[model samples]
Target: MVENRPWMTFFTHVVLILGIALLAFPIWVAFVASTHTLQTLLNPPTPLLPGGEFFENYYRALTEGAKAVGAPVWSMMVNSLVMALGISFGKIAISLTAAFAIVYFRFPLRKFFFWLIFITLMLPVEVRILPTYEVVADLGMLDTYPGLIVPLIASATATFLFRQFFMTIPDELVEAARVDGAGPLRFFKDILFPMSRTSIAALFVILFIYGWNQYLWPLLITTDESMYTMLIGINRMLASGDSQAEWQVIMATTMLAMLPPVAVVVLMQKMFVKGMTETEK
Candidate 1:
């Protein structure tokens, strides 16, 4: 039994409410700015409430896109979707395969090989951007879907996660499969892969967000405006060099950019939570 501290409970509730408001304030301001016209937004002290131009602003943003840089919000969304899915699935596939090989196999220098992969965690993409760029250029993958998707696919974090999970599986499962005349590939496909669904779902949410929010790598590789991601496209919407910025359209694009990631988190939340709890335990 616990003591009833009504004042403490009330204080905790107040703090939580304040924290929620603080976090939600940015999205609120963005939504408000999105509904108003450029002239209205440019005026000092922007409106606290939504405006009537909601449909008009979103309609124009969706169809026409920003004044010049973007082709269409829909097209950019398609591009972002492709990139995000590609990165998520690509990383998961390669990482799973690599983890299986490392965890299940006995080979010469196995620890060395594992250590080599682990070392990559210390070196981020930013650190190797120059070398990675040169290699991509050599492979003629620049300005292509392969360019945007491939470079970001090989993830040390994903490998580490999958490897740790694979290690946790009972060796009896592998022994039983061996006794039943099941080879490694068959065992992985029928047993291990199916068992990993929740973990994969959790990883998907993480990788999808990472892929969607990628700005630097994509900006470096994609020279074509058509390949610009929603993040890049959003940045382009801002008029630079003393010109009055398009606050309304930029805010709308910001909101649109947030939708996919937020939706992914909301939809996969249960699976994500379950997987994380199981993984931790």
Candidate 2:
């Protein structure tokens, strides 16, 4: 075993390096492409390294090209931020309340309700798209903020996760809370929720990423350019005529759109890890 340790270590290092490279390759390509001129990007296939004229490409893309899109990039970014955060907050709130009630309260047909909600997991958004679209349209919510945020409010996955985490908490703490004259609501607010902070944080990260990356729903619901999310905006930029195509701008815009989730992941790395481990426990 001792003699083979060196080979094992070398093999592990090689695997790790390869994994990192594979993960980073797309990002590297995007970054390099972002720095190239339109002429180079439009040429047969793009080059490997960043070409000269990074600033010129950025300037044209932002100011005078297909990616410009009449409105400022900042405006589009803010629109995306509001939509993503709204979905995140709304989803978390609904999931937490539903999970808490189901897990902690005794009520009629509770298990049935739980199972019914869980059944939603088997159905993809695509499967329900037409009905959901009709509902939103009938509500006159299409092409609006409420349309974007409300449909995502009840996440079955988040409810299941929170329920599982709540179940793992020691019953003794809940009993102690009851002994102190606390009711179910008070106990949930004061005891269960505080203990499940890590799990909540993890869910926030997951939900935020989901909301941020949502493209199809946004595309389908929003028809106005002013209401377009970053993803839709980028797609529009890409689909413009060949003469107006702006690859450098597309790369930069994509990188900008990617930054928020990346920042969230980095900032909450510890909480995210803790949440996963605590949920498992």
Candidate 3:
């Protein structure tokens, strides 16, 4: 039996509180900054408590955006959301089907194909970005949603993970599906897909955040203000040339940009943990 000691328990709680405070203090400061005016924020010691300008600052950020960022924060947020969702779902779909093909099909050079896909893990987007940009530009996908998402969607890591998980699925299950008159696609849809829900949830959270925070690729491809992501907008806000940066509006936009990814993680926390820790479906 495990014995609980009072001193140990007290120490644990103290550590936990301290860690929470350490992490949350910066976010609190940002929130406080967002609530104050630029002049107020610039003067002397920053306020720890929120100011009365919260609504004004946020409303302006949402509708008017910052002086440097041409697109409204809401439109940029929508673009980010679309890109994130498209990349997440697209990556998962392609990975799932590709893994299924590698695992179930008896095609020639099957192992070679799997290895070929696995090898792509070494070549990240940064490595081939030049050629990729060239292709996108030639196809007239620049400044478009397809340009933002298509080049980033094929995930070697996801495919490898799914393949490993599929390998763990018993051969008996496949035999049984065949005996039950289930075709390959039917078995994948009805059985494999449902069982991989936790994995999908985990990958969704990660890929959503990845797509949302994309900077270099989006910067290179999107010259148009209408297609700017939140990160791009924030960068533009900061680099507004000789004009003083609007601290309140910038902070407000930063806080707004954090919400969708935070919401995704919060809602999928349980599934994400399960997917990461649990191997067996």
Candidate 4:
């Protein structure tokens, strides 16, 4: 549309196409591996085109699972779903309430608490893993759903996102609600929440991906095979020091692990875009 500059437009398209190809290359390799026989995949420059055994590989992964790690793919996927949903909803709920209070109320040490959260952002999970594990162990949370999800749910990023959005809301809306005798809870339910739907959707997409892709925390917390997430279980499938790695099944599971997050992003793309635009304004 800006269009007197055809060369600029053509260059832009070339760059985008190359970017897409680069991003898609790895996925294409994985997908091709999923369709191949294991022996063929192990050998040489590997087949670029897909071969037979696609259904056989996927069926084995979903049903019987890896021989050594026999936890079903379905079970692992369910566990992952539970963890991801728990984290996303838990973070959104707690973050919204905390942000509301921080933005709207006059409380002692509120600024202190805000800065404390920001400080935690600098101290990532990797840094405090030991102390956090100790606290979880003391609380009898280890190897449980609470162990897997609870610590990760209280995100500084989510809290800040909500706080910034809340600040953008005009004071007049709250004043009008107060004039109409609306209590804080009532005003939040009837007004603020409705306006925050897009933000929530956007956050859901990001948080779901964050939770779903978590490897280190989940690996540390859940000791039980039954509690293993898809990501963790997929790693289990890849290779034991004893057995040859099942490239076909592993690739299939990788593709499966990729699905729910991709589905969430694709489905919520419009709301995500709208939220990003509106929140910035």
| Residue-wise C-alpha lDDT for candidate 4, range 1-281, written one tens digit per residue | 75589898999999999999999999999999999988998797898898898899889888877776778788899899999999989999998998988888998999999998778778888999889989989999887888889898776888888888888999999999999999999988999999988789888877788889999998888878889999999877765668898888888889889999888777888766664564445
Which pairs clash in the backbone of model 3? none
In candidate 3, where is summed lDDT lowest over 10 consecutive residues?
272-281
TM-scores of all candidate predictions against the true structure: 0.92, 0.86, 0.91, 0.89
Return the candidate ranking by lDDT, descending: 3, 1, 4, 2
Best candidate according to TM-score: 1
Candidate 3, 214-269: lDDT as tens digits: 88899889989999998888989999899999999999999999888788777888
Scored by Cα lDDT, where does model 1 land? 0.87
Ranking, TM-score, top scorer first? 1, 3, 4, 2
Candidate 2 lDDT over 1-281, as tens digits, reads 45768889999999999999999999988988988876787786778888787777666555543544655456667778888889888977888899998988899999999988878877767889999989999999988999988887777878888888788888998889888999988987888778877677787776787788988898889888778788888888878765576778888788778999889888988866764564445
Per-residue lDDT tens digits for candidate 1, residues 1-281, read 17899998999899999999999999999999999999998887999999999999899888878775657788788889999999999999999999999999998888897788778878878898899899999999988999999888877778888888898899999999999999999999999999988789888877888889999888888878788889888877774446666788888989999998898778888866764564445
Off by over 4 Å in 2: 5-15, 51-68, 270-281
Error in Å for residue 247 of model 2: 0.9
Worst 10 residues of 1 by lDDT: 272-281
Which candidate number would show the highest lDDT if scored against the true structure? 3
Q: Give residue 51's error in model 1 in angstroms.
A: 0.5
